[model samples]
Target: MKGLRKITPYVPGEQPNYSDMIKLNTNENPYPPSPKVTEALKNFNPESLKRYSSVDNFELKKALSDKFKLSPEHFLIGNGSDEVLAFCFLAFFNSSDPLLFPEITYGFYKVWADLFHIPFKEIPLKKDFSIDLDDYRQNNGGIILANPNAPTGLFQPLEAIEKLLSENADVIVIVDEAYIDFAGKSAITLLENHPNLIIVRTLSKANSLAGLRVGYAIGNPQYIRIAESIKSSFNPYSVDLLAETLATAAIEDTDYYDKITEKICQTREWFIRELHAVGFDSLPSKTNFVLSTHPKLEISDLYQHLEEQDVFVRYFPTIERLQSYLRISIGTQKEMASVLTIIKDYLSQLR
Candidate 1:
């Protein structure tokens, strides 16, 4: 036990797989993957599994290259964005100064930093849960900003990001755009002028391929090379064959994803307004989920009641700032309507 690595692991959302439940906890796409992915899976050469997936990740990178207008060398595919971020933390954040991130952002950031023994500083978000860009002006080893940030779903504009990049040109700047498709434009456009910038994305959100576990990073070719070096040292065949085939198919079928994401956005807007009509108000979410709070109801009790009705949502009770809020993922229109009805019935019972 003495030699074992000791660190608190990141706690993921509860995943209870019940057929009849309204599962809007883990932020997965409420819809199925593209037809292209299904077709690719059906036709994928089973024998190819005997061989190791492309160590260079040529095909996956090529697919991303065509989509992002970057060459294959500028991309590095991973088992998920989590793995890609792990590699980035190891490869780039080595300076003596503390790494910087919003205190209320993704929980995994802190876990990865601690696991690697990397010094990190958690800059507090403003009272409204918006990131204070000015707080990141100090010296740091590296920077990571989760656009449309998690839990709160509030997006910081690219102009604010470019300002950070310009000031922090001495260190690496990572813009985690896992939710960017559901929000505004990506910071990938700034890569030409900022070699230190790396944009990490995942198919889990918009592409509806969360099960495939495919994610990639876009940056200057030099950074890509460095991440690839670290990846090869760790797991050369990190991405499997089936994942590559399905991920490639998902990336190419942009139209399907676009349609599904637009539907999700519409549902999120409607859900927020409906919550407001009740006594509950939610953050202006640009992601697939919203963080909401009720004036008179206990969120923990509401979460338990919803689960008893076979509806599941995320509640972060341990985090002091988030204890009163419930982070609900956007589901189908019918499913969301059911959730609303359940809440209304619950409120009526209280009266």
Candidate 2:
């Protein structure tokens, strides 16, 4: 811990201790995983627990490869997408050149850069909060971005991403698709043409398996081998026996995944309409959350009011441009109804 001064860690969203509050700060699925996941857990053989898990996670990688229509060699699994991203930082970026990303993107990008001692530049988003792709065409060792970016819930088009890849052929371009299942488009399809492209995804969001800690990356065999080296060098058994079993089962159950996604999308649209009716404006969101701001009330005041009513939401303080807005995760219909009611009462009092 003596030389830890160089490390400034990432701060995740708040998980408050108040039991009475309706927790919606983090974008967690309101539903449980498919029954198959439970079955995998219940029927697990205790004898297998004594042995170490498969070093390469062959079974899980193959299941994902089959589901995504890619070769197993192109896949790299990790404890979570965070670990995969960390591996990317170590394997791809160097100290001589730096990484490039949106200034308001996933906070972890900055943290990973600092942790690995890799220099980086934070490109400012345009007035509409969209990335200026031209800014990234300059000098850089690698590029990383959160598709359907966090905190803002905005996404860049694949065409724009392709342009970046086309121009920056020598560097690595990492697309973090943690919320892509909700967004409907994926950059994985582009990996065949761009060997330097890497897409990182997780079972946390759409698959509703955040607790399982399953994440994977898709890229050319060579780039994936780099990640493999980093992972093997650090911890070979990163994905344990139970997690691998559950993740494979979850990936196989396509019907359950589709049904939950459909439901979440439906709820997201309704929440947007209701938010607009209450004098708030929200950006179009392809993710499981909405970012909105009201003209009359301060965001801090609204955040506190919601908490006092036993409903929790997220608020970001560092970005002054977004300090007036709140990021609300789409819960179940019943949970959202409670949030809507609280908003109605609070706004009426303001009048």
Candidate 3:
């Protein structure tokens, strides 16, 4: 079992796989995808399945380029951002020096590092859970920072990100903007001059296409080429035909994207305020999920109680800093209201 014994696998949030529960554990959008996505699915021809999926790289790449106003040569699409990230780690982070990343950011980064046998350093986050970029400027192999970092949901301003890119030109720097659609700014603007920079993104979070599994990386042409080469050598058709078409549809329907994101943000703000009004506090979040804890309540009991009520949220009960916290994904307004009611009822019974 050496393969299994190599490292601990990353544990994602629970998926109930049933429709009865109010699931908020995964950072998935509660809104439906653009109508265009549905239309694309309906119009698909079964005959296309016979041929190996031919993702129109020119078209999908052009769509991404037009949206970001970047060159088509600068983009590489993967099955998911996770695969894109894996490609990046393999393509760029091969040095003997330890790769650098925040200790508390996305869990999958560490998983990928271990799986690839890449040496990495887990730089500690500051007391407020903010990444101290200075800790990463040391001599290192490469870097991957998750903006609006996962589970905690705090966004680092674009200025700090720019500084990191500016100071660390020697190492490959990856900004995993999986949640950037919810957060305001993207570091894509920095790609023009920073040849060392790569921005990995996914439509899964904001487009309600978590099931579709499409993610892309944007960077300078040379770096993009390196990743694309690796991808081709491994799997020429990493993305299927239906996925490519639907993903393109989602990308083109920018209006639906904006509207749903606005709704999620609005709901997030209200949920934070309401949680505070009831004595539970949450971190200021730009992502569609909030990491929260009550000062006096036992987090474990609260987590279990909510689960019993058919309400599912994330609980990192074993992590030192996260033991007392529960990460709740933003759902529809009504779903969140139900969560508030349940939490208030649970707290009142304690009172």
Candidate 4:
């Protein structure tokens, strides 16, 4: 029980398992996977289930290579970005040096650190919840940043990423770009020259493939090999045959992917305007979620009111700095409109 005893597991967002519940919490793309994914599933050979999937996930990695203009040798696929990150923790960090990350980053980083017993320090975000670039320079083991960080959805510019990579040539710099598709730019542009940089990406957001659990890592050939080695040691098959085939089709359906993500972006802008009108303000967000707080009401009350109405959103009452804010994922325009209407009605009641 040595490793088991040192555990603090991650707490996932609440699921809207009911038929009538409005799920605007987990930040999943509020859209369906591409038509291609459906087709791939329909066309899959049931016989393939008898054999293990290609351990290297060659075809999917090759498709990603074409997308990023990198060699298949430069990519590593995983069941999900969470698993990809766990493999990274095992591959790069150690107990001797504490890892460095923002206090309000994707919570999984801390979980992996604890599971691996990799000591880590959380650097506090600025008062405005923006990262302090200078603070990361004092890091010990390595770096992990979620571009357009979770919950807050605030993006760190590539210039900031470049500063970290350029200065920290001696250690690994892991950039979780799970929301980068929504954010417009990616650190993958820096991977060619920065051997220390590792970029983790996923299909859960923009590609609408969350249930299929597809994610990849792009980095120097060396980093890719390390991740693959760890993966092979733990579980060689990255995903089932169905998931692999469907993810390929999903990635290939570029037009559908664009249309869906574009719709979410347009709806998010409109939703933010509505939130501001309701006396709530948000930092500019590039992810599928918006984190906002109204100066007049506590987040707990807002959460309870929403929950009472079967409108599910994410609120982190335990994180000290985030206690006042609620993270609301972008859903269909209709779903968001309902959220706005509910807020407006509730505010009027309070008056």
Candidate 5:
């Protein structure tokens, strides 16, 4: 046991294998990826697996660069945004000063900080579950925030992000925009002015490519170079050929992806309204999921009821602030209607 690393790993949502079950726990997209992704997969040469994938990630990076209007050098691709974030923590958070993040934000941030032995300070979110921008005004080695933050699904406006970048211009500030597509504009729009800003994105949610595990970070060329150096030293081929090909195809099919994202957003709003009608109130959400609770009902009891009916949503019991809430992902129209019906049945039984 000597010199062994002991740390708690991030617990991902349960992936149930039931064909009849409605799964919305992990915030994955309900729809399948673009037809382009399917065609790319079918056309990808199986013989290419004999060799290592492109070490530079040029193919995928070029696709992303062309899509985002950035040079290829501005991207650092990874197996997932989680990998990209881990690299950022290791490469940029070396200073003795503490790294900063919202205490109640993405659970992975703490995992990475702990695993890397990077000092960190988790500022508590305000009573409304909104991040207090003023809390981040202090000195820190770096900062990472999940805009349209997880579990709560509340978005921080771009103006607030700009102010954070303006105040902390000297240190690295990473905006993890994994769910930004459903929300609205990206922090990428602010990139030209803020060299210290790093924007992390994933194809898991909006692109319906969670199965492929493709994620990348956008930043100034200098930051990208530093992260790339660390990535190459750790694992030269952080992205594989199949994933690169499929993800490239998925990115190029912007129309398909955009249409699905809008549908999810619209469904999210409708679901929130329906939940309100049933005496459940949900956070104003910008992401694909909503954190909701009923004033008079037990969240645990309701969560169990939904599960018993083959409907799955997320419930975080360990976090004090979220014990009373259930985070529900927006599914297809029929699936959402089923969930609503199941919830109503539960309410009727209580009466």
Candidate 6:
């Protein structure tokens, strides 16, 4: 318990055990991963299981580089984007200076800063829940932001990100694009010009590889070297053998990724329109989830009501501003229809 007190863990969305529940809390892809990933797993060699996997993840890096049209030297792979981000904090961020992000952005940013004992300052978002670029231009040792911010499901355009990069040439600018495939643009294009820029991505969202725990980053060779050094020092084989194989297959199958992303985006738009018609004000989302607040229902009460009806969605009760809102992951049409029916009945009961 004494050692445990020193560690504050990140709280992921709830994974409830209710069998009938339409689970939509974690923003996981409603569809299965590509058939290639399944084939890779089934065809895995038992002999390779005895040996340590690639310390450099050469094959996975090459696959990623080829997909992004970047050199293998410009990429680095990790167990998850969280590990890649942890490496960034240790390798690039200095304790003497502060890390900056939006106040109401991803909760993990704050957790990581605390875990590493790094100083940080959170710039508050504007009234509309959008990041103000001027706040980032002022000062900092490094900058990290979720492009399509978590919980809020809002995104800052690539042009705005370019402005931040142009303004802060001295500090490292890390863009956590875990949700970028759902969004319109990616900052990977700026890597050649901006040596200090790092783009972190994960297979969890668009690629449907959350269970595999594969994440990667694209940056200048220098920055990639820093992450590699830290990874080698920490855990050279952080990414397992099977994960590397599956992730490589997943990245190579861009057609599957594109198809799923398009479907998710389409479903998301239809869901938003339906929600609005039912009087729930949902933020325009670029990710697979929607953040919304009902005009009449208390979020807590609604959450409990949904749970009672075997429908699970994410609810953050701690953040006062967001307590009235619920973050709903886009599930299948049938699942969402069930949720809507439950909501319609609940609202009718309230009336």
What does candidate 3's lDDT look like per residue over 70-179, in tens digits? Answer: 88998999998988999999899999999999998889999999988999999998888888787877889998999878878898888888899989888899999999
Tens digits of per-residue lDDT, candidate 4, 1-351, equal 464374668999977688888899888888888888888888898997999889888889878878778899998899989999999999988647779999998988888898888899999999999997799878588989999788788988888889889998888989999998785589888987799999998888889888889888889988789889999999988687888889889878889988988899999999999999889989899989999999999779989999999999999988998889999999999999999999999999999
Tens-digit per-residue lDDT, 1-351, candidate 5:
699877899999898879899998999899999999999989989998999998988888899999999999999999999899888888899989999999999999999999889999999999999998889989899999999888788889899999999999888999999999987569998999999999999999999989898999999999989999899889888788999999999989999998999899889999999999999989999999999999999999888988898888999999999999999999997899899989898899899
Better of 1 and 4 by TM-score: 1
TM-score quality measure for candidate 4: 0.97
> Per-residue CA lDDT of candidate 1, range 154-208, in tens?
9998899999999999999999999998866899889999999999998898888
Q: Give the winner by TM-score: 3 or 5.
A: 5
**lDDT (0-100) at residue 276 of candidate 5?**
99
TM-scores, each model vs. reference = 0.99, 0.97, 0.97, 0.97, 0.99, 0.97
Count clashing residue pairs per candidate. Answer: 0, 0, 0, 0, 0, 0
Q: lDDT tens digits, residues 59-111, model 2?
A: 99889888989899999999999998998889999747878999998889999
lDDT against true structure, model 5:
0.92
lDDT of 5 at 197: 97
Global fold similarity of model 6 (TM-score): 0.97
Clashing pairs in 1: none
Pitting candidate 3 against candidate 6, the one with the higher lDDT is 3
lDDT digits (tens) for residues 1-351 of candidate 6: 465557777899877777677989988888999999989989998898899998889999999888888899998899889889898888888747799998997789889899888999999988888888888877688999898888788988888999899999998999999998886588888887888899999999899988889998889998889889998898989999889999999999999889889988888998899889989999999999999998788889999989888888999888878889999999877788788889988989998
lDDT of each: 0.91, 0.89, 0.90, 0.88, 0.92, 0.88
Candidate 6 total steric clashes: 0
- For model 3 the local lDDT of residue 314 reads 89
